[model samples]
Structure formats: C-alpha cells, structure tokens
Target: MPATFIRRIASPKKAVTGLAVAAATAGMALTAAPAHAATTSSAADAKAIAKQMIPDSAQYNAFSKIVQHESGWDVDATNPSSGAYGLVQALPGSKMASAGSDWKTNAKTQIEWGLNYMNDRYGSPAGAWDFWQANGWY
Candidate 1:
C-alpha cells in the first residue's frame, strides 16, 4: 500500500454556513446583511445642481467661486481644524440642519442653506464673494 487521498467540496450554502460558524466561534458577530450599492454624487454633480438652483449668472458665478475655494464643490468636504463640513463648509455642520436633515449628503440642501446665508448676511452672493475676497472668509 502506498497512499490514498480523497477530497470533498461543500456547496455554496454549506460553505457560507461553515464560515458563519467559524466566525461565531472566534467571538465575531455576523449580524450584517448583504450590502447593496449606493448612489454617490460628484463635485461636478454638485456644481450642476447649483447652476439649476441659482439662475442669475453673476450670483451663480459668485456662489461657485466661494464654494470652489471653500470645498472644491465636494458635498462631504470637511475642514479638519474648524470642524466645518459640507459644500458650504458650515461650521459645526449642524447649522445646515435648518435647511434639511439630509444636509450631510444632499447638495441641494447645502446649496440652499448657503444661498440663504449669503442673501441674509451679505445681501447677495456677489456681496459675500467680495467680503470673502477681502477677508478670506464669509
């Protein structure tokens, strides 16, 4: 007699079950469900959304300039030092909640809040941009 070997293959369901058992034995919980793909917006998308929201060319350009400097049009942009967040870099981020609860992820919400802030504080986006240009913030 020389030697003999046999191999067995488990089905997908059994293999998954075995993996779950092994993970549980290692003190890990397999409570997470299968992940689904989520849609994400890009900086360009944010700009487009802003264009649609702000129809005035000068106002839109001014708003765009501020956002470009503040967040580079990133919806989830954050200032690590100031803790400012979102497209407009709302300090504390929670300030944008008055615009909408989805302020963190929705470009429209951030833009709406930013626009309102500019209108209320500086009279217009162009005015805000002027102030920002001189003071480096608005």
Candidate 2:
C-alpha cells in the first residue's frame, strides 16, 4: 500500500463555542435595541397623551412651549443643581410620586403630573407660559 498520512482537523467543540459566543452577542444586541425603542416610543406616547388631555389647542401649544424650554420634552431630564426632573422639571422630583409610582420611568406619568402642576400653580398652561416668558422660569 502507498504511504498514508492523516492530519488532525480542528476541534468541533471549538467551532461550537465560537458560534455560541456569536449567538449570545447577537442576542444581547437585540435586547439593547428594544430598550432604545421603548424610550423613544414612551416619549411619543407621553406627548400624545398630553395632547389628548389638553382639550384646548391653545393650551396644548402653550404646554409644549414650556416643556420645550424646561426639559425639551425629555422625561428623564434632571437639573443637577435643583434636583428637578422629568418633562416639566419638578423640583425635588419626588413630588411626582403622587401621579404614579412609575413617574421616574414613565413619560405619561410625568406629563400628567406636569399638567396638574401647571393648572394648579399658574391656573393654566398658557398662564404658565406667560410667566415663563417674562421670568425665564415657571
């Protein structure tokens, strides 16, 4: 018989381990995407809820103006010096607990609390805007 030589091939376990790592990394990436999407969608949902609650178009516009200046409609915004937080930047932030337990993470809760604050403090969003325009803070 002619000389025969057999070379060992790479280990199958190593190939499987590499594929497992790749699959785990891809799964983690997918998880990250949902969290990002949820944050964006929550902002949209909060804005929609705010619009729906503010039956008057002028009031909604006024509310939008205030929110734009305060936190740019970001529910997670926080003022480092004052500890104010959320879309309306409620000082102490804990005051939003009255709206809901999810106030820290839920934009809708923040919007609801913000609207109530505007209505209670300034009599209405337009009133708040007027104050904000004149004083730079509402």
Candidate 3:
C-alpha cells in the first residue's frame, strides 16, 4: 500500500457521556422554566355556575364551609381511608370521571361532580353538609 490513514472514532462511553450531558442540560432548562398553573376555577365560580341547583344562600354557605373544612378548597385533596378525592371527595374517587378526564387535576370537573352529587343525593349543599356533620360523610 502506498499510503494508509486511520482515524479512531470516539468510544461508546464518550458517546453516552455526551448524550447524558445534553439530556441533563435539557432537564435543567425544563426545571428552570416557570411551572404552569393548573387550569381551575374557584368554589365561588363553581357556585355561580351551578347557582340554580342551590338557590338557597344558607345551604350554599354550609356546603361551601364543609368543602373548605375538608379540603381548604384544594381540588386535588384526597382522603386515604375513604378513597375520597377532589373538592367533594367522591368515594372511590372515580365518580368525578363522569364530569371530565381532569377530575384529579381540574377544579371545574371536581366542582361539577360535587354539585351533581349534592343535588342527586341530598337535594342541596346544606343537606349534604348536614349529613356530613352528623356522620363525617355525605
């Protein structure tokens, strides 16, 4: 052979290291980005939307109080023993699925499910709260 030239490529270890560095940099950027707030509405908003379902002001207040006591207005709240989850803490947790897919993370769905539950089971928020007070459930 008149002339021969050989060039060694970077090893697998070096390629892996390069990939790791790139991945880490991407992860850091993602973490540094501001978190997006969960799409949600307040209990007041929920009440306003469903006001026709709960016409009585006193009943609305009681229901609002009970939910506040249970979750402090957190739609993601969960009770371990009862598997009650979301604003209204539907037993089995999956009951809110009827409203929408975001039941676990969306406040509007939780509120809608809660309002429906109260109307169907207890006739009103106050009625549901009354049962909750007496039995620690509704």
- Candidate structures ordered by TM-score, highest first: 1, 2, 3
Sorted on lDDT, best first, the list reads 1, 2, 3
Q: Please, what are the lDDT tens digits per residue for candidate 1 over residues 54-110?
A: 999999999999999999998889998999998889998999999987788889989
lDDT per prediction? 0.87, 0.81, 0.71
In model 1, the clashing pairs are none
Which candidate, 1 or 3, has the higher TM-score?
A: 1
Report lDDT (Cα) of residue 9, candidate 2.
34
Report RMSD for candidate 3. Answer: 11.3
Estimate candidate 3's alpha-carbon lDDT, on a 0 to 1 scale.
0.71
Model 3: which residue pairs collide? Answer: none
What TM-score does candidate 3 reach? Answer: 0.60
Alpha-carbon lDDT of model 2 = 0.81
Q: Give the range of the ten consecutive residues with the poorest summed lDDT in model 3.
A: 1-10
lDDT, candidate 2, 1-138, per-residue tens: 112322333897775565556667657322323342234345567678788888899999999899989988788889988999988999889899899877887777778898899999999999999999999999
Top-scoring candidate (lDDT) = 1
Q: 51-137, model 3: which lDDT tens digit per residue?
A: 554567887687777778877676767887777887777887797889887777777677778888887989878788888899987
Q: RMSD for each model, in Å, please? A: 6.4, 10.2, 11.3
Report lDDT (Cα) of residue 114, candidate 1.
Answer: 98
